[model samples]
Target: MIMKYAILSQTKDLMPTLGLGTWQAPPDVIENVVYNALELGYRHIDTAFNYNNEQAIGNAIKKWLNDGKGTRKDIFITTKLPHVGNRASDVKKFLELQLKMLQLDYVDLYLIHVSFGFHCDPEKFTPLVKPTGEYELDMETDHIATWKKMEECQKEGLIHNLGLSNFNEIQIAKIIKEATIKPQVLQVELHAYFQQLKLRKFCEENDIIVTAYAPLGSPGAKDHFVNKYNYSPDTFPDLLGHPEVKAIADHHGKTTAQILLHFLVKQKITVIPKSTSENRLKENMDIYDFELTPEEMNSMKKLDKGEKGRIFNFLFWKGVENHPEYPFKLSDDKD
Candidate 1:
């Protein structure tokens, strides 16, 4: 029953490598999902302001604590600053609001949700869009100033660790140059298909622990994007159904997901795969009992699809690729 964890370089805090990802989780169902996860021995919960389910998650954690299941100190909660709150002036305001929503005095980690910013009416909490259906860009969004504010929040004990999501190497380097405290984590899209080898190497050199989102290649994302944004790529990689992965899973007598998760955790990379089923939740955390052989690990490594393997390009934001701080180059634009 040994659980894996990564120690934050700055705070020496232990973050459970396997966390429950709450993105796209329905509000009504999330409370029960989170509570069940805690009962099943999950100690890390990954959420975000834009996810709009923090209150539900908070209620679950509150119930778990009230029932004497666990103390607040036993769980690590990670939330993020939304794109609308990407500037220095808005960091404290949003963090306080998030704290209020989560009913917590402090968060274990707070990440800047993305590198780019968007103009939005604060009351609505949705990005302001132009007549062309594109989000109104906040071109002057300043990463260094925002990082300064995050550092200040860390000093005030509001956030134990500060990190970034959806930020590229160049954007991260800019922050590191001006940071009094460097980022402790970098969460991004990662799976066998899109391993992010270069970025992981860079973060490794900088002592930033990498967390893999969509660790199963996010099988449901294509439909989600199509239904919501009327967009879908010509092709999407299916890691779960891959023949190589299945063969390995069959040999190991484990589920495809367990194999996928173990592959990342074996490399010391963190993974947060989203699922609402009680059985799947329990199944996800069961990877600790087994280990992947080096040959099996390398077999999965060959599945890397590089840039084209990426599913979350943020193109649904409609002209985001044109933004100065857009972290990814379009697949067509790549050499």
Candidate 2:
């Protein structure tokens, strides 16, 4: 049970830079993949309560930590808050459930997933079931209030750091303006297709660290954010197949994914690429030893064409569309 640790600025201190992404990853697959990644020196793992693998993830971490590779302190872990649990009063209850599922005392970083709110219609659906859900914003309570609850958890030692996911500038501004503690990190969708340079700049100026998911521009197809947002990863040539990427892979004797992960880390942006395979998990961790040149970095940066995407924008939580800060915008170049 060896742990991989890389320095990343979480708040005032450095945390492990690379973490395993568990979005949409199934429990059976994630268990082995996580263990393998840890064995390959990956200490940070990213999971969400919505991912439905919290218990499995908790089990894996518990086993690994107790197997003599190291203690929980040696690993940096993160889990996110679900959109349905966005109310101020419900935040702690949701977290407590996640903890019970995770079988852990605390999480390293806890994030508020989704910015504005949710949009849902349980009555008129193919799956037609359950209580109606609405935008947390339209409900009349403030996200800042919910965030305050998150901060209280931080004070209570339920989590080590507090961050946000799917939050936009105005909402982030509100949090920053009213927060007893400003958000330490932000995890967002970023890749060659949608670099989000402007958002990145704002976070950087505010001393907030960013973690880039969807680095390969995937989980974006016919349904979900990739489609609701109208982004096609297939539209962009796979970086793996690019001649420049190929040459670099040959030059460094690494794979394309390694090059991509390294590209982000070199820019000081933490990356959490999701893969449920043992080989891929280990391959991702093998990135720290290499460095790409300034010219090479610029070449990769040229890949931006402005597309926002994700595999799961299922909208099950309801009324997400009304939120001004919904991650994808109608005006974005959806072609």
> In candidate 1, what are the lDDT values of residues 206-324, reduced to their tens digit?
99999999999897787888789887555777789989999999999999999999999988899999999999999999999987888998999998878878888898898988778
Clashes of each: 0, 10
User: What are the runs in model 2 whose C-alpha is more than 4 Å off?
Assistant: 1-11, 119-138, 219-237, 307-319, 333-335
Model 2 agreement with the true structure over 127-183: per-residue lDDT tens digits: 212355333443443678888999899888898889999777777888899988788
> What is the overall TM-score of model 2 with all chains considered together?
0.84
Give TM per candidate: 0.97, 0.84
Model 2 scores worst on lDDT over the 10 consecutive residues at 119-128
Clashing pairs in 1: none
Model 1 ranges off by over 4 Å: 1-3, 332-335
Q: Which of the numbered candidates is closest to the native, going by highest TM-score?
A: 1
lDDT of each: 0.92, 0.73
Clashes of 2: 10
